[model samples]
Target: MAEVATGTTMAERRASVDLTDRRALLACQPDDPAVLAEAHRLKETALLDFGVRDSVVTSWLYAKCHHHIPTTAVETAAVVATGDGGCLLLYNPQFFVDIGLAGVRFVLFHEARHLMHRHLYVEPELRADPVFHLAAEVSINHVAMVRLASGGLPTRAVPDGTGGTVREPVGVDPHEIHRRYAEDLSGQGRKPLSYQDFVDTDLVVYRELKRMHTPLVLPIGLCIHADHVGGDIGELPTDGETVGRIVGEVLAEAIRAALRGNRIARDEVLNLVDRSEGGGDRLTRMWGTLGAVALRGETPRTRRVQWWKRWLADTLASKLREGERLVYPKKQGAVLLALGHDPMLSRRGRERTKVVLVALDTSGSMSNEVVDWITSLVGQTDGVESHWLSFDGVVMPFVPGERVYGGGGTNFQNVVDYAEGRLTIDGEPFEVQPDAVIMVTDGYAPRVSPAQPDRWIWLITDGGDDWPEHHNPPMACHRVITGER
Candidate 1:
């Protein structure tokens, strides 16, 4: 029953969260100690089956910590907590009756999500609604629909320990169970049922003699990918139009909750929000890159910009210094793929070759989010000429795999100095100069650099300070305000 300290760093908090009470989740059953132990083991197997994360499972367990499970098979299942501790749930037996083992597992996880995440805390009366029980029913029926659609189920029923026939559980195929579970919640079956129907069925089971499953959307392929890829794929892919709609609906609900002045944390909303709102692909790429970077640094936002610029710079520098040429590797792919090409020329060869140089400023004012993201982008690609420049008083192109160090000053002139000998953008044979230069900074640096007649400069910053009008000539600059300032 040890809880994590609230103010610790994210890494520390994550480690603590992962170590949450497995025994507590097991403490729910009032059965014999052996049976309860078996239940705890079964829950672990179920979490694995459902591809739930330790953090998420821990959170669930903590929420469920306050309430004990129903004592008997015939007793009505009800959630007993409120505000931060509340959840609306019911144990339905039909899912268990109809779909078998998967039904039981699906409901358990679904109900756990409600109690553990405190989904029922949103309202006061939901716990009393018959619909509470239906949560699991709809969830498992959805599983049935999906399983039935994608060929067929393998084991419909298993042996009841007592020679009596017990329903085969749905938990065995949690991924598939979640998928169909979502479909059922969406009311996609032949005789369509409302959300109320799903809930009411659970009520009937509680009132009558019967069944199991949790109600929640399991977007198609998500369960498969989550189970295989782990819960941290960053962003979930849009699974066609149907699943996309469900994701959208889920996002809308989250937003509505936020707008209602709920105290839900921003990151939690972000975690649950639709992956497509901003740039899903961009966010995923950025997250993957950040995850690779070391945890020490500034926050996510600052590190993202810094890392992106660094990636652009280092990658560009590596490609250029090696004498590699950027080319269209294949017309099918949209991005330019730089490759080492022969400098030897035929009569038909063109004399001019384009090169790109990128520079990033890592200053005390910059955030960690930007830095980590930049590092990640650097790691994902090849053949691009990238240069990472960290400046306070001076600018230097970053070496591959080097830790960035800078404090208190920045000067663009070093960029000019660094490129002085080898590369001249003006078609000078003296050196192979960059065709374009990209500069990333917080605009806290000296603005002017020595003149380069043919260089293109793209500047990205927070835009607090004005650009010096006396900047070097023959330079066309694009200024990007990242909104951080």
Candidate 2:
């Protein structure tokens, strides 16, 4: 349900998307093995080239998606960000051959940048205005041209099967789109932005477009999911929020990777971080949640916990689905309908609401930094109901910033009982089982089996014993390393 640059009716946009869906991606090679092999090779080379050029952003974005679906549904290539913090990069093999290497690189970079800009993470306000979408398309294309350093459109043919070639123009060129805007504004006796100034920031493009009587609308074929009218009509974009989170996580990951000797990843991440909202406030918040301590530029000696938080975040995302949901009725519904989404409203709630149990064993050994970190982490996380337990010999529920009583011998059993619906909070006994149990403690206490062992995720303090690791049945466990920086 996208607004066609051709000014087609909403009905027409929906119909076109329906026609495209019939061309769903082929999971594996069909009759010709040679074509599939060549396609794979091209994709590999593109990935390599992209990785070499901008390692951090490209690497993280590409890894977040699975790109094996060969589709005729999309004219060029498209990405469907899945509900599970993953993405589907569906493309027509012929399109790859069509655009050639330069085009492919541009498209891949375009898609990743869209993710970076939280493009598909469309909000109601942004979607209600077509000018915003147009601005985004222009900005995305402009950024691609600048970064890839492509002088002109790369519509050169790349060889396909049987000596045939696919030579197709890729996305809407920012220059051409800007030229249209410039001409329209000039006719209206209004000054237009230069190409450089026009495409400077994501919001700037929209603000400038609003200054014009009629902004240029590039056709749907040009970009990925640029719509108040979604590329997938009728369905609400449920996974968009999750995709947004994943995008941040990956960007932060890339930045950390860049810091740790990934020169290519570093350059791209710095560029992305620089251009982000609030002058990289979004990245700062993301890294803080991830407990990515290296962003503090801590001394080289104590930065031993680089990859642990990434691993922890990924693990927790899978198991910690909460019961409640948020609905976007007006704009999100309109946007999804514009895309012709199947279910109309993207309904995304589980049967039961899950409670998160954060049992902090506040023994003398536990650091305030770790406690403060966990408090911030839990405070920022939404959607799930969190129960904080500070325990030593006895289990007791406490609120954030509430001083916890401890110094007694550690008692892991009491924490387990409190989490397993057998304990009380504020004099009220728990009635339901928790969905996930996170224990922050020094592994000095005896281990007891919970009703669900897999739901138990234990974080042991530095140099502390990890009893769960040596238990009869192992569970999810990680070391919470403290630094002196």
Candidate with the greatest lDDT versus the true structure: 2
List where candidate 2 sits over 4 angstroms from the true fold.
Answer: 1-6, 9-11, 14-24, 27-33, 128-130, 156-168, 226-235, 238-485
Highest TM-score: give the candidate number: 2
lDDT tens digits, residue span 1-485, model 1: 01111122212112111111223322334545554445445444544555422234434544454433322221212233322323322222322333434433544544454453343343324322333323333444444435334323323444678887753333223334333444544454333233334334333323321222333322221111111111232222222343545665564444333322234633455553334346765664544343221222224442443333433454344433434334443432322122222232223333344455556776634455555554555454444444555666766556645777876667667666666663333343225566556556655655565455345344445543424323445343333324353
Worst 10 residues of 1 by lDDT: 221-230
- Candidate 1 contains a number of clashing pairs equal to 64
List runs of model 1 lying over 4 Å from the truth.
Answer: 1-354, 368-383, 422-431, 466-485
What is the TM-score of each predicted model, taking all chains together? 0.25, 0.45
lDDT of 2 by residue, 1-485 (tens): 22327342333322134221223345323456665566666766776787534643465466666444665555666565554655666566766765667777777777777767766557766754556767787787777777789875557564677799865455666677777779889999988889889889879888887776755554645444533234443333434456577787677567545644457876676566446637555555654454443544543233345454555565566687545454556775664456454323444665555567888887836666777776666566665678888888888888877888876787888777777657666777767677778888778867688777888887877777767755667777766665543
